[model samples]
Target: MKPLQTWVPVPENSDFTIYNLPFGIFSVAGDAPRAGIAIGDQIIDLAVLADAGLIAPEKDYFTQPTLNRFIGLGKKVTNEVRLQVQRLLIDEDSELKKNPRFLVPQSEATMHLPIKIGDYTDFYSSLEHATNVGKMFRDPENALLPNWKHIPVGYHGRASSVVVSGTPIHRPKGQVMPKGAASPVFKPTGRLDFELEMAFVVGRNSDLGESVPVSRAEEYIFGMVLFNDWSARDIQKWEYVPLGPFLGKSFASSMSPWIVTMEALEPFRVKGPDQDPEVLPYLRTEGPKNYDIDLSVGIRPQNGEEEVLCRSNFKYMYWNMAQQLAHHTINGCNICVGDVMASGTISGKDETSYGSMLELSWGGQKTIDLKNGATRTFIEDNDTITMRGSAKKGDVSIGFGEVSGKILPAK
Candidate 1:
C-alpha cells in the first residue's frame, strides 16, 4: 500500500496520522468518560457523532460508560467505524471533512480512562525477559523454573488501581523481610521499577464455559496500547516466596492515552516465536501473525534529567497474543469487553535491551549510568517513566504512541 494523503497537515516527521486512528475516552470538562478517536492532533468526539446519528450501534451499547458499549460491537463495527472515520476525516468528498466545526483541537481535550477494565491479567510471555529475570535469583543450574515453558505464566492483577497515562503513582507501603529476618517490617517501597510491556484491549465478551479459539481471537481484540506494571523489587522478593506478587504489583499500572486498532497494525504482522514442543490444542495457530514492533523506555529523574534506558522488540515474546487470549478463556473463565491483558516485561537477549530497571541494574549490583552523570539502580520518587512502540515498514509506520507515569512519595 502506498502512503495515504491527509488534509490534517501532519508533517512527515509526525507519528500521529490518518492511518493510525487510535481511540480513547475524553470529555470537554466535567462530563462522564466517553469514546473519542485521535486524528492528527485532534480528538473526534464519538458521543457527539453518535448523538448526531452519524454512528449508531445496533445494540443498546452506547448507554454504558467508557468504550465497552461500542467495543462489545466487536471487530466488525470497530473496523467499520474506523473506515468511516478515516473516509470522513481524510477524503475531501466527506461531509464531516468539509465541516470545520466537527474537529476539536487535541491540546484542549481532556483525556481520561478509555475503558472500564473489569479485570487485569499480565503474562510472562517474553522468552528473553523471563530468562534474564530468572538468572538474577536462581543459580546457573536452575535459571528457568520448571512449568514456565509448558504454559503461559500469568497472575491476576489489580484492576481498580490501573491508571490512565500521566497519572501520578504514589510509592506503595508494604512489608519487607530483610536478610536473616524471621518477620517482615512495614515501609514504603525503596526499589521501585517499571516493566516495559504491550497490552491488548478486549473487544468482545466470552460467555462462561465457552472458549475462544486462536483462530477467532483477533475478532475479540479491539486494539493495542503501552502498559507499565510498576514493581517494588524489595517487597516482591520478600513476600513472593511461595505466592506471586500481590501489593507490590497492585499499587499502580499505567497505560497509554490512545489505543491503536488491530486493523491499522494488520500490515505489520510478522512471524511469532516458534514453539519447541507442541502447544495445547486451543493455543495452536496456523502461522505467526505477531508484529515486529520496536519498543523503548525512557526515564526522567525528579531533578529534571532524562535518559534512554533500554531498546527492545515485541518479537522477543515466546507466546503470541492469540495464544494468550485462547489460554485465558480455556477454563470457562468469563472475559468481558475492555478487559486488559499485558505481555509482561519485554526484553531482548543483550544487556542493553533490558526492559525493567531490575534487569538493567542486574539485581542492584551495577549502576545504570545516565547521560547527565547521575546513576540509578531503582526508581526514585518523582521519576517519570515512558514506554513507546512503533512498527516501521519502509515509509509508513504504525505507532502505539506511548504510556507514561510519574512516581510520587508515599502519603
Candidate 2:
C-alpha cells in the first residue's frame, strides 16, 4: 500500500504509517491504560472510538492496565478490530475523518505496557551467539552442546521484575569468583551486560494438555517487541554451574512500549536459517516464518557519548518464532495471554554484529576501543546500554523506537 497523505507531520514517510496499526495503552489525562493506535504523529484512542460507537464490539475490553483482556478476545476479533481501526483512522469515508478533536497528539500521550505478563521464558536460539560463546570456553568441536541442535533451549525468568523502557536498572548484587579462588565472594555485580532480543506477546491461552502446532503458532502471538534481557555475566558464570541464571538475569529487563502487530510486519517476513539435522517433529515449520528486522546495540558511558556497539538482524535466529512456541508447549504446558516468549541474544558473523560484551571482547580477554580513546569489556556502573531496531526498504524505515536503560550503582 502506498503511503497516505495525512496532515500529521509523519514526514513524507514514517514507520507508524496508515498501514501499521500498532497497539499500545496510553493516558492523556491521568487515566488508566486505554487502547490507542499509532497513525502518523497522532494516536487514535480506541477506547474513545468504542465509547462513541464509531468502532465495533471489542470496545468493552479497553481501560485496563494491560492488553491481555483485549487480546484474549481471539485473533479473529483482533484482525477485525485492527482492520476497522485502520479504516477509521485512514479512510476518508469513515467518521474519524470528520472529527479530529477526539484525536490525541502522539506527543502528549503516555505509553504503558501493552500486555500484562504472567510468564516469561528466554530462549538461546542464535547460532553465532552460541558458537562465539562456546568458542570462548571450549574447543570448536565442543562449542555447541550435544542437545543444542535438537531442541529449543530456554529458562524461566522473573516476570515481576520486567520493566518498560526508560527504567533505571540498579547494578545487582551477587556472588563472583575472584581469580584463583576455591570459594566465591559476594558483592554488587561488576560485569553488567545487555542482550539484544526480540520478544513475542501471547494473544490467546492454550490448555495444559494440548500442544500448539507450528502451523497455527502465529495465531497465538499477538505482536513483537525489541527486548533487552539485562545480564550480570560475572555473577552468571559463578551461579549457573548447576542451575541456570537467577540473580544475574532477574535484576532487570527492558522492552519497547509499542507492540507491533504481526500484520504490519508481514511484508518483511522471510524464511529463517536452515535446520541441518532437521528439527524434531514438534519443531517443524512449513513456511517462511521470520521477519527481516535490523537490530543493534549501542552503549554510552556515563561520561562519554553514544557509539553503536553492535549490529545484527532477527533473521539470524536458528529457531524461528513458531519453533520456539511449538517446543514450549511440547510438554502440554499451558500458556496464557500476556506470556512473553523471547528470542535470545541475536548475533552475526562479524565483530560489530556481536550482541554481548562476552562476544565482542571474547570474554574480556581483549578490549574494545572507543571513539575517544576509551575501551570496555563489560558495562560499567553508570554506562547506559541502548538497543534499537528497524526494517528499511527503499526510503521508508519501519522502526522500533528504542529500549534503553542506565546502569546505576547497586542498592
Candidate 3:
C-alpha cells in the first residue's frame, strides 16, 4: 500500500499522518469540547463537519465532552467516519479542503481526555518487566512466578484519577517502612516512578455472565493510547502484599489525548512472544496478536534538559491484549465502553529497556545520570515525565502522540 498524499500540508515526521486520523476531544478558547480527528498539526472538527452535511451520519455524535456516546455507536459507525475523513483529506475538491474553519490548529485547541472512563484495569503482562521486578525483590533464578505464563495478571485501579496529558500530579503521601525501621512512617513517597504502558479503550459493552472469546477480543476494542501508570515505589512496596496498588497508583495516571484506532493499527500487527506450556483454551489466540509499536520514556527536571530513559517495544509483551481481555472476561466479567485496560510496564531484554525507575536504578541502589548534571533514583519535584509511542511499517506510520505529567510538591 502507498502513502496517500494530502492537500493538507504535513510537516516531515509529524505524528499525525494522513493515514492516521486519531480521534480526541478538543476545544478552542471558551467553546465546549467536541470530538475531532487529528491530521498533521490541525484538528478536523467533527461537529462542524456534521453540521455542514459533509460526513455525518443520521445524527451528530461529536457534540459531547466525552467520546463514550460516539464510541458506543460501535465500530461500524466510527470506522466509517474515519474513512470519510481519509477520503475528504485526499480529494482536493472536497468541501473539507475548501472550508478551513473546521480544521482547527492544534496549537490553539486544548486537548482533553478522549473518554470518561468507568473502570480501569492494569495488567502485568511484560515478561521482562515481571522478571526484572522478581529478580530485584524475589528470586533471580525463579524470576517468573508459577502462574506468570498461564494468565494475564491484573488488578482493578482507580478510574477517577486518570487524567489527560499535561495534567500535574502531586507527590502522594503514604505510610512507608523505612530501612531498618521497626514500624512504618507516614510521609511523601521517596521513590516515585512512571510505568511506560499502552491502554486499549473498550468500544462495546458486554452483557453480564457473558465471556468474550480470545479470537473475538479485538471486536470490542476501539483504539489504543499511550498510558503512564504513575507509581510510588515505597508506598506500593508496603501495601502490595494481600491486595494490589491503592493510593500509590490511584493518585494519578496520565493518557495521550488522541486515540489511534485498532483499524489504523491493523497494518502494524505482529505475533507476540510464544507462550510456553500453552495457555488455557480461553486464553488461546491466533497470529499477530501484538502491535509492533516503538515506545520511549523521557524525564526533564525543572528548567533542565530532557533525558531519554528507556526505549522498548510493545511487541516484547509476553501476554497480549486479547489474552488480557479474554482472561478478564473468562469469569463472566462484563466490560463497558470507555473502560480502560492498561498494559503494565513494558520492559525489554536490555538494561536500558527497563520501564520503571525502580528497575532502571535497581531499586534505588544506583543513580540515573541526567542531561543537566543531575542524578535521580526516583522522580523529584517539578520533574516532568513524558511517554510516546509510534508504529511504522514500510510506507505507513501511526502515532499515539504522548502522555506527559509534571510532579508537584506533596499536598
User: In order, how many clashes per candidate?
Assistant: 0, 0, 0
Per-residue CA lDDT of candidate 1, range 1-411, in tens?
676777776656455777788888776666665677777677777766766666655323543457777877778887888887777776778666666656677787777778899999999998888888787888655777887877889999999998989999999999988779898899998899999999999998889998888899888888999999999999998878789999889999999978898988887888877887878777788876688889999999877766789999988888899889888888878899889999999999898888999999998999988776778999998889988888887766767767889888999
Scored by TM-score, the top model is: 3
C-alpha lDDT (0 to 100) for residue 336 of candidate 2: 98
Model 3 alpha-carbon miss at residue 255, Å: 0.5
lDDT values for all models: 0.84, 0.85, 0.93
- lDDT for each residue of candidate 3 in 267-294, tens digit (9 for 90 to 100): 9999888889898888888888999999
Model 2 regions lying over 4 Å from their true place: 1-7, 394-397
Instruction: Report model 2's TM-score to 2 decimal places.
Output: 0.95
lDDT of 3 at 130: 98
Roughly what TM-score does model 3 have, to 2 decimal places?
Answer: 0.99
Per-model C-alpha RMSD: 1.9, 1.8, 0.8
Per-candidate TM equals 0.95, 0.95, 0.99
lDDT of 2 at 234: 89
